[model samples]
Target chain A: MTTESVRVAVAQTVPEFGAVDRNRRRTLEIVRKNADADLVVLPELATTGYVFESESELADLAEPRDGETASAWAEAAAETGTWIVGGVAERAGASYYNSALVVSPDGLEGVYRKVHPWNEEKRWFAAGSDLPVFETPFGRLGVQICNDQWFPEATITQARAGADLIAVPTNWVPNPDGDGRPGDWTAGVHQAVAHADANRVWIACADRAGTERGTAFEGQSVVVAPDGVPAAGPAPADGEHVLAVDCDLARARDKSLTPRDDALADRRPEVYDLG
Target chain B: MTTESVRVAVAQTVPEFGAVDRNRRRTLEIVRKNADADLVVLPELATTGYVFESESELADLAEPRDGETASAWAEAAAETGTWIVGGVAERAGASYYNSALVVSPDGLEGVYRKVHPWNEEKRWFAAGSDLPVFETPFGRLGVQICNDQWFPEATITQARAGADLIAVPTNWVPNPDGDGRPGDWTAGVHQAVAHADANRVWIACADRAGTERGTAFEGQSVVVAPDGVPAAGPAPADGEHVLAVDCDLARARDKSLTPRDDALADRRPEVYDLG
Candidate 1:
């Protein structure tokens, strides 16, 4: 494995419901601005905001894997010689899935569907059947969207599959009491830190900001190091911002939390019995 | 299914290496001091201490599940009408296992061996082959030791098995770069919060303090509510302390994060592909 550092960026943006063009443009702008970074991540459903009024409304906003948003993101990635992971509302024939696309300079790298739909999403999107990790020049990458973060298995599966970095495209909503405690971090941010620490992989969470319909998205996007500490921005909780940090991909490959213990290698799945 | 609250106490104490008597007495003192609490959690290997120099040293300190430590803690639990979960280095037949015992007013309720032994532990202890959750007066209780907290499957399995509360008997060591970030809390604490939030289960972690054989234990014992916020002291980072909080076990039963979403029911195990 190569011991090289890769620049990673997490862009927190706000999108208007049903305003596909504006949302796509906003994400494109963030990518262009953070061109120096090797990878840039955008929030869940960036091109089509969450809080769909109906299945028809969601269907109207959804696109295929090779649709407009993917083409635009691919073009931008090619222009900047960077990789982008962004969320989209995907239409696969009659079913719609909340998905994220991994676009490198070459083109579309992979597509990851939301494995577990959250709340109202159950009504509009079909749950994904698989978790796939993609290969990149810097390292193996895994992409999971939004509510998928709630499942530890999502991160664990990816990390176990040799993913060095997991980019999360999330539209974080507030917790019942509040987003998080002792600081500005949302519960989602803490989850990212825990996932990074537990799996020995870098986790970059790009969360959306501002209110869409009646739902107010939390904007505290964060980039967590393999050591579980926040290496960059949890940005402001309710504003658009960009956070970039240099991550050593090799640290993820060496799952050793210490000389004798490895994070992934140490798992006792025989005892897990995950029923 | 009870909606009533359960008073939980996490006692953080310092144990001298090989001073089993003193450590046991200290634990008894803490239990006696917090007699009002319905449940009390103590650190991993609370009586024997960690950092063994050799296999013989570990063997010398190891005890049967019903040995001195368990008997004493059981007596204390009977006297206080409380339930106690504490770690012990177990001598089972010819093998040694890192394990935790659940003692209640009735007697020894259950035992949980650490599934994932960390670092030097692998050299001395036989890995546990199963994960078990005990039926408690307050709720279904799950117990896991130290490094077991690093594995999400530990918590997920117990939660899925109907555990309302998971008591962690941990001797938290400092991470490669300090224990935790953003505050005095350790990475272990972050893991507790994430587990509680993701599984919708109450998590009470009792950790140890002071240094032993060049190894220092982090003393930030924390009790996280089902909402993923610390309800009581992370105690102090380096001192003996007791953290008590009233946890509504019913909230753990109701895994719903939102009206439309239930944390436990939302899991997609089919896609996990843990291997």
Candidate 2:
């Protein structure tokens, strides 16, 4: 099952902390400008800030899967005739899940709640138990949010579930004492590249930029090919901008140089107690 | 025992393919400049390129651990009054092993052969079964080369054997078709970061860069803090470079963030039969 080539864009910018309306408007504007793209991505918690000071604040910003924010994105997708992948605080039952929503021309296609929460995220969001991937005009796309990117199992699961492209939306906070050095973000990008190389799948990562609530955002948003080479994004320190690139999905499925399945084919999971 | 803080520089650079003299000269220059650094690093097979189409070429580059090239680095370490860590093809018995050598201010401190031959490396180098770490002024440092970076068992073994910092010397090849975009090297860095984060230890990675023998190098030589944030080198298209950073060995021994030597503390090695 080969896939066709598609153009993807990663919108790297800083959203106002807890300013949902402003964030949505800016996102829509960026989406409109890149209407020609097959897929457009935005950062995790793009509507809400990474720092959730209180449950009350989370409740205020939390939205149902079919809420206004989702509807707005759905409408934007239909208008642009493109697929949109972005992060939002999802209100599921009595709890909230850090989720990534995939909106298509038809409407909301899927929502992937972050499987692993990092540090403070545990204080607010519940962990997701299920993993899912979906078919799109571009390819079989899998969506994951921030913390989920850190785990190898997360991306591997998506690949096992038949995902061709893995899109991660992240509101990554820059190291407070990193002294503005580029190395501070090595772990984050490492996961993305490893998954792409190991799974032989394309990865599109959109990261938030600029300072919000005393946290500086390191704007190294990026897109990687199956062999783990950066295809797009990962802009410089001051680059809080949009990056677009055309990617051939078939190229990612090349199994000669990097046998995607072979990397995980022999995994003996019975002994790995990664707690 | 309490450990003292020591500044170690993991020099990540791209060695010219089969350019032994030039690569060795560059290594000496970096060692000289980073004289104040307790330890300086170089990538795997620094004297030879990663992709050797024929066995003759591999054998031609293969040298004894006490050969001229290794001796040169040893002399440099003594002259600069610092330790040097790097990768090389070693001649052992009737076979060859991809090895990492730790040259100290006194002389060759220790040598570790690659435990797990990765991909093409299997065709060239024999695997070494033993795992060990050495004592240094900063702390106990463990050495591993390339593919060894992917396995948690290897790292956990080093930690169990008493290592404060795990230094990986790698000649990582970039995707042949990657167009030099950011975030292209996700897998390599991901393995390093996860190892550091999960182990709650520091990881000093020295990676090779530049296009040698038609293979491209992604120069994201990184230093992962005990907290898992990476202090990385400049993403150069191709060339020689050094990524130096100050590492606090004492902080790595802190039990608050990383409680060591428990069931949860050590990774079980019996389960992974896939590699």
Candidate 2 chain B worst ten-residue window by lDDT: B266-275
True contacts kept of 2: 0.18
lDDT per residue for candidate 1 within B1-275, as digits (tens), equals 13468999999989888999999999999999999999999999999998888999988899999998889998999999999999889999999999998999888887898889988898899988888989887889988888888899999999989999999999998886844476767889999998998998999999999999899888989999888988886788798999988899988999877788888888887888786
TM-score of each: 0.96, 0.71
**Candidate 1 residue-wise lDDT at A260:** 87
Worst 10 residues of 2 chain A by lDDT: A266-275
Which model scores highest in TM-score?
1
lDDT of 2 by residue, A1-275 (tens): 11476888999868888899999888899999999888999999887767788988999999998888789998989999889999999998889999888899899998988776666776798877666788887678888877566445566667766677888898766433334223445345656765687667889889987886677767788888877677875665454688898888886555445342244442334323333
Docking verdict class for candidate 2: incorrect
Error of 2 at B258 (Å): 13
Per-model chain B TM-scores are 0.97, 0.88
